[model samples]
Target: MRKFIILSAFAATLFVSCDDTRKVLHEQYLEYVMHTDSLDVVHDAMTVHHDALKTDTRTLAQKLKDVEETDSIAIADLAKHQVLLKEQATSLSKLKKLIESHADVKSYFMSDSISVEQMEAQLVEMEANNTDIAARLTQIKTELKMIEAEQESLKKTEKH
Candidate 1:
């Protein structure tokens, strides 16, 4: 009877240990899914911002070409702004590529070989990168707005 009691207690403990391990794994899986979803949202936003930047660059280029010869100063300023815009676009494109390369979230999540600590470290790095990208996008948007305003001011001066 004592042997039976000991065996039953050990079996019960083993079952609980397995159940706890599964619960922890499930939690980790959910966390990984959330991180992937967040990344997707950021990627989508970056795509929209990138497209807008391209459109703005084209518009600025057209304005530069259409400006009157007499407005050399305005043309020079517009040309400078266009150059800046091109550089930003290039940087953004590179960033987008980087993000694309790191977008294999599913494979990483599904792999049993990867340790939890390693996955957590990767998530931290990705979050930091995402933050940097978001800040750069905001800065680019602000600069674009300022350039557009300057162009409008130039147009007003031309009318006079």
Candidate 2:
């Protein structure tokens, strides 16, 4: 009777151990899924930002051409546009870096050996970072549009 009791205790311990491991594995899988979803959102936002960047760059180029063609404009006005162009270029460089760094989602996430809690923390942090980057990209694009519109108005005034 004593031996039977000891064996039962050992079996219960093993069963509880297995259950714990399985629970952790399940949690890890869910974290991975959430991580993937966050990455997808980031990718989509970045793509939209990239397209806007391209369009804004083309607008800047056209504005530069217009500024060069018109001799009536004040040097100060041209300089302002030039400075805005430079700022836009700098912002584009930053956007490119952000995109390149996060484009490879696989490297950002670990599939094995990481604890569930760690994975959740990492995912939350990444989502926050991506959100910030998306906001910056949107701001830059809006600034570019405003500058482009101002330049267009300047051109119209010069023509009149």
Clashes per model (N, Cα, C within 3 A): 0, 0
Query: Against the unseen true structure, what C-alpha lDDT does each candidate score?
Result: 0.67, 0.59
**For model 1, how does the per-residue alpha-carbon lDDT over 1-160 read when each residue is reduced to its tens digit?**
9999999999999988866664575466566556545655765675576567557656755765775654777777777777877777686787676566455664764466666666666666666766676677678777767777787777677556
TM-score of each: 0.63, 0.52
lDDT of 2 at 66: 68
Q: List candidate 1 stretches off by more than 4 Å.
A: 1-69
lDDT of 2 by residue, 47-160 (tens): 565455446555545655666665444445556656766675676566556544543544334444555565557556555756666676567667656655765676566566
| Residue 77 in model 1: lDDT | 79
Model 2, poorest ten-residue lDDT window?
102-111
Query: RMSD in Å for candidate 2, one decimal?
Result: 6.1
